[model samples]
Target: MLPGPRRLKRPSDFGATVRRGSRAATPTVVVHVRRTIDQDPPDFTRVGFVVSKKVGNAVTRNRVKRRLRHFAGDLDAQFNTDVVVRALPAAALEPQRVRDDLEDAWARAFARAAAC
Candidate 1:
């Protein structure tokens, strides 16, 4: 699990990440990268998950959230950014694919964030 401070818990934070953040995506998942103004730890990067109802029922959505929360450890970036990983409907069929897609998404997200 992400440490409490490293998690993006509020709705507004998620909204900002999606709205103003740089984005990178595959067919299965999208990674949003937003620079944060919060004055907490400098290198800490916050993360949130958005597994919409289109992905599955509650049980399945929770499962995907858990999986995403686990693998997203590797996504600990050096900047003070808010990162959101949004799942697409096709992710219901395969969980491992999400990790792979997240890896690709993270690379693209960093590139895009740099440009921003």
Candidate 2:
């Protein structure tokens, strides 16, 4: 058998961690983040992606999700807390552009979390 793509499970978990968390906005992305002070196993911090039909067909949406996942992994070290990243329509833009936007949004989200 093959392993499925590693990803966060449970909407409730994402909600609880970043419900009232801070938000960072960029031209192409918006990131919502919250600190998770409680965890039983503390296995790994998680992230979620939300892309809507407005972005495009299945392929475009999946591409955006993949990009977001890669971007999230690159920023894993910075995210000491749990985060939920919601994709905006602009995410369908060029790959490098999307990456830049996400990086900016993440920086802002991290800054906000630190202030709290």
Candidate 3:
């Protein structure tokens, strides 16, 4: 589970990050990354996951979300950033692929941000 401070819980936070953040997509996931300047110490990045019904039924969606939370927890070392991860339907079908895609998409998201 992600620490409380590292989780993006508000709808406003999700909207703002997804709207303004740089985006990168892999076969199983899409990641939106935004650099933030508001947190007091900003030692850790905030993250949220979106696993819609399109991904699966309730059980599958929860499983995918749990996987994403685990992945996001591992990536929280990034400071002063907000990340939203959206799972593709393929994510429910390929658990291993989700991990690789999450890392790849995040790197690509930052690369895209840098290029902009």
Candidate 4:
């Protein structure tokens, strides 16, 4: 599980990331990353996961979320950014593949952020 301070908790936080974050997708998941300029500390990054009913029942969704959180755990503290990872149905059956995809997505997201 993501630590409390590093997890996105509110509906608005998800909405903001969805609305404004730069996005990248793999076959099994979509990623949205939003960087903020005035965020305090300047090195905290928060990560959230979204796995809907389309992905699975509660048990499956929670499993996928746990896998995603585990992957996000490896990320170093970066500039203030909020990232949302949305899992697709296929993700329910593939943990390692999702992790590989997430690694690619993170690379792309950071590259995009650096351009601006």
Candidate 1's C-alpha lDDT?
0.86
Candidate 3 lDDT over residue span 2-108, tens digit each: 98888889999899989999999999999998888674636778889899999989999999999999887776334468889999999999898898889999888
Write model 4 residue lDDT over 10-92, tens digit each, in one string. Answer: 78888988898888888888888888655453357888889999987999899998889988889653467888888988898
TM-score of each: 0.91, 0.82, 0.89, 0.89
lDDT of each: 0.86, 0.75, 0.86, 0.81
In model 2, where do residues sit more than 4 Å from their true spots? 1-6, 39-43
Q: What is the lDDT of residue 36 in candidate 1?
A: 76
Candidate 1, run of 10 with poorest lDDT: 35-44
Better of 1 and 2 by lDDT: 1
Residue 25 shift from truth in candidate 3, angstroms: 0.3
Model 3, runs deviating above 4 Å: 39-41, 76-78
Q: Give RMSD (Å) of candidate 1 vs. truth.
A: 1.6
Model 4, global lDDT: 0.81
Over the stretch 1-116, how does candidate 2's per-residue lDDT look in tens digits?
11133354677866775568889988778888777677553445567778889888999999998888888777753545667788888788656788888888888898888889
Selected candidate, larger TM-score, 2 vs 3: 3
In candidate 2, which residue pairs get closer than 3 Å at backbone N, Cα or C atoms, i.e. clash?
Answer: none
